[model samples]
Target: MELELRHLRTVRAIADTGSLTKAAAALGLAQPALSAQLRRIEKALGGSLFERDHTGARATPLGELVLERARVVLPAVSELQAEAVRFANATGALDRFRLGGTHGPLLGGLVDRIAAAHPVAPVSTYTAWSVDEIASMVIDGRLDFALIGACGESPPPLAERLTWEVVGVDPVFVMLPEGHELAGEGELELASLADESWANVPGDGCFEECFATACARAGFAPVSVFETDTASVVHLVQVGRAIGLCRATFPPTPGLVTRPLAGAPLSWRHLVGWHPRSPAASAAAVTVTGATRAAYAEAVSRSPSYARWLTSHPRFGTVA
Candidate 1:
């Protein structure tokens, strides 16, 4: 007989509660039925899954191994079921479009543009720090389109599979507390931050690579003393805990300031990308591209220094 989800859940319940009676109650099954089910499962595997005693039920070594797999499989199955339910409930949810991108105002703009014009379209939105993460989701059919920020002069490793449009280029700036001496300073050297702690979120993409490379070039390696998300990165810098990087278009956060590096050194080549398989991918790319460009302009308006840097370095976010 094929193993069912209930069989797995029953094993988990028995292991978690450590008592057959409790596990049966938790699973809403009678004690005899649960015991019979466990016996059948154990017989199929040619082993006893649980040991019975006066104290309680204990998983055998084999049972322990099975439970380890259960942890990973259960959650994924739950999410799959949930996603199925959502799509089923929402008519034409996947048929119209889906979008994903890096977090911040640009993502918001991209989502809004698509949603505004096709208000009833079955749309899904997601965000990630790594351009590769966004690109993978697009290629795997999770997202129809993505807007990503690449720090290097070229598209990310997976670019060949998808069409990319550079909506705008954004300079990378060091975010520091307003009270810090280097706040708003023009063209500061990377070495100046060498003595300071860095705050970074774990990412496999340009964020970590660029920080490592640029700091390496500056004759130092950045030590990320704290790992956190975008909002927390802002908070970490605001409290004078650490320095972090952001695109020039990041909206101004209170109690913090952003300064350009002297050489126009590190910036992201922003692109709106999509897999060509979808008939609507080209149209989605246009809407996302325009929204991203407008969002960059809005971000520039919020920071005068960043705008000047963008104006001075016309090739800031371009790839040759």
Candidate 2:
């Protein structure tokens, strides 16, 4: 009845697919075997992990708490296993690299570069919703590097222990309905948008903090509504229910347009950090920085509106 990595993974698979049958198929196990494992996990954890319906399973409140922690634990465990294999191979060289990233354009770009440079080395990625969580993994040696977005002159706390580099600065853009009165203009001042409701997820990089801080400076406190669903955020913006903060890296969406915030109150500095204990941490950081900039360049090409904004403002917005 003891919980192990396998049990945690079972929870993840079920939560992800939302069905016992699908989770079992994904893990190459019979449904009955997977069902039995769930029972054992529940016994060990002292509660049912999921509330099942005819359609599928969903985490209970207790299950939600465990699943959240399990996300972090699973990545670290996966990296640990990979490292053990490298040592077992006895070549004294890593067969692959591991990385974790908060939401941003740099991730896609960095992965592309790593595969090209280390064709033989396998690369694995894990997506985290917050920089703080990503920092934990970097400290644990689970990730060789982490890409974080910070505001103003602040560096994430882990910077002191790791080799950190500023890859580039991403200017925060305001996305709203295409037909909105303000969208007719090419740029906007944060103060003008103060009355608008904001869509934000707490702990999403600097999303909430930057938005609130900027609003305070604008002499108004924005009405913040928590929305974690991407589709909901899109709908709110399109219908003018709320406005959202985004970066140029996000592709153009129909019915929406992005404008630069004049006097940019919420710019985030792109940081790529690696601990010294990781092999070639400094060298890897350098390569990733270059890759990040390249990614932005490609993003501009794919998004004409963003490209125009970037061109009109060669320099990134300074934190207010």
The TM-scores of all predictions, comma-separated, are 0.65, 0.65
Q: What is the per-residue lDDT of model 2 for residues 146-239, given as tens digits with 9 covering 90 to 100? A: 8777765676756666777675666778788988889888779888987788774345445566667778888888766646655677788888
lDDT of 2 at 110: 79
Model 1 scores a TM of 0.65
How well is each residue in 1-320 modelled by candidate 1, as lDDT tens digits? Answer: 66778889999999999999999999999999999999998887779889999899999998998899899899889757645654444333235667787765577766666678778876678877676878877666667778776666765647766888776777677889999988757778988888888875555665676677888899897765577888898899999999877777777778988788767567777777876654435555676667667766666687777767766688753332
lDDT of 2 at 256: 90
Error of 1 at 286 (Å): 2.2
lDDT of 1 at 180: 95
lDDT of each: 0.75, 0.75
